[model samples]
Target: MPTQHKNIVLLIADDLGKYMGSYGCPSISTPNLDRLADSGTRFDMAFASTASCSGSRSTIYTGLHTHENGQYGLNWARSHFQTFQYVDSAPKLFNQAGYRSGIIGKVHVGTEEVYCWQVREESGTRDVAWVADRCEAFFQQATVDDKPFFLTVGYIDPHRDISTRGGFGNQERQYGTRVPLLDVKPEDVEIPRWLTDLPETRQELVEYYKAINRTDTGVGLVYEALERQGLLDSTLVMFTSDNGPPFVNSKTTLYDAGIHLPLIVRQPGAKAGIVNPNMISFVDILPTLLDWASIPLDARSSDKDSRLPTSPPRQGRSFLPILQRTDLLPESDWQHHVFGSHTFHEMQNYWPTRILRTRRYKYHRNVAWRLDFPFAGDLYASITFEGIRNVEPPVMMGQRKLKDYIFRPPEELYDLDADPDEVSNLAGEEACESLLLNCRERVTEWQKQTKDLWLYRDGQSVTMLGRYAKDGLQVPERLDFDVENPGTKGVEMTKHLGVDAYSAGIER
Candidate 1:
């Protein structure tokens, strides 16, 4: 394997959905993620900030968004959102650029190990032989310590059929095809009329496509243990998914199947069977893996690692020229506006959503005067094992009242070109009320240039969480919530289940 500093492998597949067969989803068998998207580049507009799962990996290892990365939800310190302190993540900026940063399975991220060299807790989906024997002994201990690495291998198998709302079972579609479930009917199947579609939601999507064909054969056994340690053509194999899927309105809802995912890359100077339709996010994977190992980003690390600290500018922008181009490079200079936020899901209730997606529009701004119930109240109440097997109301008592069919919405605008299943509502479509008021004033000036204007406040203002909770304290249970329901019937059941959870997010 010809050398160079570009050795990195980021593979996540929790709620993965850009439907496989290299993003065309002819129905599942992701032939080694379609040969890693035909050996390189396959984005088709990637997105994810808050579709839950620690607000989409705290906006993909802190490239911001998820309200500046406070992690906006999932007990990452209680979460009012603000991140960068998992010891300055992004594999500690590839371990301060000298590289060597491993993580086996489901490092849900931000519990903290500060850019992991080791955080092996395999079981995001029936341990798959303990993550293929702990990622083949963590790449044979990072190629016998000649470490120029940045490995991440997480798989929670089709996020347990999208957290048990179900559909994607009987495995085998690694690009060979046959996981179908778009307009339901495998026996009255239902679970997203804002929640609750049973027959075990199609037997939990056929055990989530048999855990996505057993995490694509554990990502072809970690790409054959990085091609038997030659580190697969100098690594750089980034496949994705942390949000989107986990049923209902798509993991903690920010829509686009809860944060449109599936972004392939593969490496060896990239550029193989390409297709990079721009609009990437997850905060540009730590300055594109610190600009492919040349590193540098530190800029006095604050404001969650350079969203701004002293000319730190980087909310992500560098697909290295779309990994050598497949065309889609213009959302006015490639930074395709995308932002999302959703603090806590399930129980301690926190619904702070603010998203603005592009590639034909999607804007949702519901600053929680309360109302966003898909799987009812705070969702993802993290008890795991499929949230105690869908909160076992007698092990499946009408999908446990399908959380009384969630309801919530204060604003929503979708037009993914006449709705890419975002099901109508151009925010009161009067010929797109002046393009939804200029996408809500460009999402309130990108939430006041990232200071997140109290998420466009109107209620619950502790004045910027007490001016960033005194020096933006990053972890003490992050944003620690135990209870805070100021009611209005939980804001009218999160807006009467926000348009039937956006028309049961017509899956893919």
Candidate 2:
């Protein structure tokens, strides 16, 4: 391997959040990941921009939000969301700098030209030992090629099977050495506050834990492989999930349960077991990787002609400066608030929403609040959801009622210190109106920067309205037009969200 540059290894799990013992949840066994947390720095305030798989992964790879990158929904099977071709990608940057870049497991982001790695082995197999074997081969190839390596290993365990009732893919299967099938009983699992603790749910959890144990073993196996190759000291390892757990109210929602994920980084020679409290979004991952590789932070990944006059620079800065800090970084040095943008999960799940979260408050803006929040195929078919819907009278989902979950208001505001689960809404209250408006403005500002087309006013997209705004088309400065009056007379019109650049479409 090249002596001047350190290797990079990114391990991402599918449909996982902070469910491990290390993240203070003892319900599931994640010993391998726990050890990684103990040996590296664990970020407690890490987040995903979008809770959907492809959208979140694209955010990590491109250092851009889903709206900015154009991966608005799922990219697999009937859904066709892909990152924009003009975007700068981490793998392409590493490849440009002469590193041996490869992705051994699942590759969710699309358009080969955007994520142009030197080697790509995209697969959906859950046999993690096979994945370890492939990683070992890639390391050896890098050694032969005499270059530092950059590899992304995506684990498919702990995610639901394509078959709706596959029970998280847990079965009487054989796993190789160091991979023990955990004996976690249904009673041993702790039902999250976001879920109902029922018999069917418990039964399904037993299988979910088994899958989690396999994923943990896979992490250990890959670490052992890197150690065997004598690259432990020369590699930068990071482990995180693409999204939260594959359950209702978690997978597709902008609530903390869905977007707040586990992020552990073990940079070479960094202090071990340090807990980092600085807030970070998934968009920062790419810049941090490039920072570690000693590449120019603003270096263009490619010079190909773009649809836009110029490709947008990454929205986030690197966390390398504070990666090893145990204390909370000051607000001036790091951002205290985190933002989330979720457009869709499956094509059918089109409840476009934006969220702004600070330490004290959380605000959610549901653009299509009238739509009875659609479900991802897996979540709708899950045993947990089935139990929630089929049970006797007084149907409720955790502390929230089932109807409340299905039908939501246009805006929701919660005091996080009082309601971490975001059950109580204050958006409609008179006293909280000031805080509500402030949060709404902040989220709208974020949408404009990302060029989000979901910014709706008067029941229409602001981006669409911008195309005709210069021609004196009025975009009423309100969520929806008043049906009783049915006129724009004396109403304020503004191009607050989509202005100037958006007037002629995103082509500019």
Candidate 3:
């Protein structure tokens, strides 16, 4: 049979983690997502490179880490971080391949030049039906133009609003209509293992779950619209979240609760209802979309015969092969580990962290371990935190001391097999020394390769300093700095290379 060009619809939920009914969150109602999962492949170990909204979305769009993409912090904040002008975003790539790309809501990644979407609706409403209506219009336009379309519908559901009182803000009306909200009882809420089982926590979860249900309705509306337009079978639909829920130790952190996202991909002419346990990163989304559409990454440069360059080398490999296959590939063939780099979320939240996670273990290198980890504005004022702060001695949330959580060590290692909740710290333990060293080395290597600025200790980037040493020493290759034990051992060219020798803006 001849291949058919597939339309793409990507649905991204803000501040949602693996808390859906499809992912077996026993209490939260997500019938639409559950049904979609039943008809598609569900990825068990999908992770975002960063837990911050813009950074994670930029990674998804460009298939490059936050460090490489230059969107290190929130786009909406004063930080005004955006993707590099040289970077090729997902919409630009898809547009090059004759796809009419549109983003419905929360286009939070960067400047318009980088994204360059044909249609953009930047509404902040939590109304799923309203957003779905916009999706329907985009699909209709695609049909009229006779072009396969790529649409990203970003939902602001399940994220705490600006209200001082903790709530998901699901009650806000859009287009003079509101989807009937679900009444989620606090008693019925199944609190995640990472959060404390307090009354305030449960009450907050009730609001979160209600917002999720509303998001589910929005998903259903989009699906129905596709079906009505006879594009359901021709569209490759994906549902995922930007990061984990907006709370302490989840939204802005590098732990599993933060980076581990829910991924469901339903491709046309592929096997359905399969659960794949392969580890996939947000960076893989671009390459996967291109592969699925049978569009080459360098299609524009090759076809136009113009010097228009292709995107810089992608960091992620396409998983479309596994998506099409019926049987799950061996663990060896699949990506076994994922890396994360988080520099900032809001303007004030400057706790930089790097993480490496495998099936059995996870390691975190907290760059600013000495400083008290600053909280995202919403989390600090949360009802859950309200409960925690009022208690004497300050109740710990999920085996994490309020003090310990804030004043973390330089390194943290957890045996995920034994302690899935990631409560135990094995970094300083003698028994786990080798594993910690290996993880540190791997993460540092990645940082160097990506030219990560967060590879810092004592406010100095070891990677940058090593580069300066190699340049001054006139070495053939760059020298590796001992990130684990900084200043202990490395190419000692500082005596020969003065601070004046290094130029500003050389470390990007």
Best candidate, lDDT-wise?
2
Highest TM-score against the true fold, candidate: 2
lDDT of 2: 0.85
Please estimate how well model 1 matches the true structure, expressed as its whole-model Cα lDDT: 0.60
Tens-place lDDT per residue, model 1, 1-508, is: 4244467778888776665667665555668778878878887787877777766775677676655545555643434333534235675555655666777767655555444555455444444555766777876766677667777777766665333233333332332222222333344322333334444455555455556656776777677767876767767888888887566556776777778888887768656888877777777776777776666654323335433223224566656645768776555667766776666654355667687888788887776635645353323432222543555464331222333224545678877787675655568768889998788777765665555534333253322433444453221211112256433333321111111111221111
For residue 157, model 2's alpha carbon misses the true position, in angstroms, by 1.2
Ranking by TM-score: 2, 3, 1
lDDT by residue (457-483, candidate 3, tens digit) is: 345665455545655432222223355
lDDT per model, in order?
A: 0.60, 0.85, 0.81
- How does each model score on TM-score? 0.35, 0.96, 0.90
Off by over 4 Å in 3: 1-4, 174-178, 298-311, 324-328, 457-459, 470-508
Return whichever of 1 and 3 wins on lDDT.
Answer: 3
lDDT string for model 2 (95-155, tens) is 8898999998889888898888888999888888899989999998888778999999988
Model 2 poorest ten-residue lDDT run:
497-506
